[model samples]
Target: MSSDDPLAAALAAAGLGGVQPGDTRPPEPRIEVVSDDPAEPTGPRELWPEGIGTGVGSLPGTDPREASALVTGETPEFPAFPELPARGVGADMIGRTAGLLVDLAVEVVPTGWRVTARTGRDLRRARDLLAGDLDAFDDACDRIRPHWVKIQVAGPWTLAASVELASGHRVLTDRGAVREFAASLGEGLRAHVAEVAERTGATVVVQLDEPGLPAVIAGSLSTASGYGTVRAVRAPDAQDLLRDLISGIAAPVVVHCCADRPPIRLLAGAGAAAVAIDATRPAFTGTTAEPRALDAIGETWDEGVPLLLGLLPGTAPEREPAIGDLARAGYDLADRLGFDRRRLARLAVPTPACGLAGATPDWARRALTLSRELGKAFADPDE
Candidate 1:
């Protein structure tokens, strides 16, 4: 690679040129090692020390204050920086994350968000909206001083797949651009995490949402012209990028994919503490769940990677939902995989099956309330 190579220059320009984020180790199980001096504690670290259930980032409302109040009120122990995509424009997943990028900028086009030469109105709006959300969430936290808070961001593959290049190709199509954005995101997130941590005085957890990853791995995404499909991203390559991103994060990172056939094993190997998925999806429940998918999930759990199981629907169902009914799939997974039900509390968290941005306001509130109930149920049946 020449020093003047455009790819190299772009990466260097993004502050990622010669930087290795942290000591990123390959995902492995918690193993006890025999040592003479003070033996290191070999017990698995508790993933959730406080109250458990939380939403998958979004809700139904356009007002950040109302949404934050609802979120922190119901799921105070594990409240997320509520995402109000219903507010439109720069508030959607991709656009909102653009606000968190350090050096890159994006503008919304007819096709969707695209790379831009400089910071534009769309980018500024994203930043402003996100800033407003932070303020709203901060105020909400002031009342209930939770010990930990969660914040979501788009994972690199999902971000790349969603945003397009100036040439109209997806950013994931260009390796250099993918790394550049990933680096810029990491730098931006470091600052973002520090600020949130400082403001709330709580351990801030990061959730990396990867809704586009399954399609990227399968090469199923259509080109802008719809005449072709993007080339499948190899698993190792995906894991490498994810590892770097996860390692750089000072806070615990949860990689979430509510899609069918999420690459569970792949995500498990990428150094994430947990893999969040739609527990209620056909891919995860009953006879419909495929053998390979079951195996992938089983393997992930065996490696001590906790599963953030989305047990209830993001949108409310017709019938009244019950605690036992909401927890059936979780119990079944354990039975199918030969895990003790008692261990589910330590290994799983209850969340909505997906983002609740499309849910009715009533359902959104109900859903999170149920999540809290489900969390308590998972933790102790005798409670």
Candidate 2:
């Protein structure tokens, strides 16, 4: 690879370059290691609010107003526009993204929501629910004036994986349908971001959730027939579609996937300002069989991109982890990656390991408090 290649630069910085036989001397440090794209932002902290804590979207219950209040009050510095999936079909990820489609509609079916030839009551309900959530978000923000607010939607691949074509096949199975959906999603998100900014008086950051992406790329999505899997999507094609969708949006973008082996490099290559992953998962903690995942982490951080590390448990645990315990895990990661521990504060944002929608109300509140404290510990461990 050329010296200017971002992957090469990251590999060199992390001292992961290939070595020849009989080479005993230590590798020399490369001073110019950096992102291949000069246009890439300095770091995620630049786009993120000064506060270090945020949520992973979904919260428990059906009331948007209550969810918004809790999120803003707990994570005042970097509050996320709460997603309440517990509200049912239209309020889930696919239903929410379908609501954002410019000229398309979806209806609930026995299998799930499917693309419809025309608009219907199902689509209307999705839009209405989303609007109610936005209203609640605006009301909550008006009192606190958060510096930045985050909103998440299903990314193209996950959307395609979820919705079925009229023919009963997944939209991802048809190349043309995939492209059309991406265009519609991009158009709708641009308007959504603008409206949130207008209403909340805060800079908007968009997060593209793709929990189903690994399955999509791995050809593991069950065929509509329930006996087979869809064909795997090539890495380049997936990256290109994501890049196109992200480029069209006028906000800092974060790609989040809680998959055990999220395609970290592919997401970074697709123009994400930050990649969110469940850092507490075994794959990232060096206990899993996959070593490359850890290397991807090192390379990502070395390229000056920020990581939204999911350090807090999403559900209630027997007992919550202490601030020092969470801080130690971060410091350990830095040491393993050969980076300075101080970089954790500048390059990481603490979040729940995943969404807290399944937790009891009491555990949910405790999780957010712990997440906020973890962020504070990252900034000032001694305190």
Candidate 3:
């Protein structure tokens, strides 16, 4: 269903937005919230981590040290959340998460802020949890009172890659299961978008999390249960599945990946309004391949996809990498890609490569502050 609104049509046609250059759009910071922190307590009492736009439950049994390792790639002291609670907390999850985002938006967006919430991983059983989750999310927004809101759910490919089959194998290997899962997820998302928009009176922005997407397409994720390592799923074919997911929402869609090698073209073709990525790690190798990254960046830029570049590190200050250091490391990639600093500026939205749930409270706050500062530096017309 094509939108009659020019902005919607333009965004849908191009599939993204380019960097706003020298154009002094005063920084209207919308607090974009992440899902799940494995290190914090999970009780209902709302606790907003410093610098985060909203509240989220801390993961159980995850040490601050171990969580830091997951984000920074250091030796692990503890394990990450193997599984999060997903059986019956649908409405509650929606409200808690939305309330959390609203909490953050109130602090960040001065003129007005967009509030959003993320539905946790356990989407395979979406059919069971969908309606309740949507209802709870809508109710939560009524309490928080936000202007714009986002709803996030795990994407199909990632879900297919991650979810276990009844046989204890991966669902990705079963085309039928994949299809069913995609349809269910799409249905849930459609209902979710409507509830969020109507209940919160917010412009709904649905972001699908696909951290495992690049690996899934690259055939990097193999079956640990001996289902013969999963094979690469083609993007053109996958686009149909993705299109269904995108089509369900009447609002703009953002496809976010923690992986370096995102399927940018497929996402662009699938009608994504933006492509959010973690650029903390290099996607391509040495200086020789910088051009490819630049070209990829340019293609997405030309297609109107804004690159949400992950810039902040989630670990402690000791573990965190400097932005200038990261920028220099990305210099060849940026230069080779043929993106002028200005173009890069327009295209980039710097952030931590992933969520800071693993970091200590101090680290999370610092990460947010650093991300904003780095974004300012990157956005400056002079630099």
**RMSD to native, candidate 3:** 20.5
Candidate 1, run of 10 with poorest lDDT: 19-28
**What TM-score against the true fold does each predicted structure earn?**
0.88, 0.87, 0.60
lDDT of 1 by residue, 184-284 (tens): 99999999999999998788989999999999999999988899999999999999999999899898899999998888988989999899999887877
Candidate 1 stretches greater than 4 Å from native: 1-46
The order by descending TM-score is 1, 2, 3
Pairs in steric clash, model 1: none
Question: How big is the positional error of residue 145 in model 3, measured in Å on the Cα after superposition?
Answer: 6.3
lDDT of 2 by residue, 124-167 (tens): 99999999999999999999999899999999999999999988
lDDT of 3 by residue, 1-383 (tens): 23576665675565433323243444667998988767776553211111212111222222333322222221111111111222333222232222222112111122111221333332223324444444444554455454545455677787677555545556688888778767766765676667667766766666677778878778777775565678888877788888877887677787877765677777877888777766655555464344555567678877656666666665676656766765554454456666666555556655566655466656755665565556555655355
Local distance difference test, per candidate? 0.88, 0.88, 0.54
Residue pair clashes in candidate 2: none
Those runs of model 3 whose alpha carbons end farther than 4 Å from true positions after fitting are 1-147, 284-289, 319-336, 343-345
Cand. 2 TM to true fold: 0.87
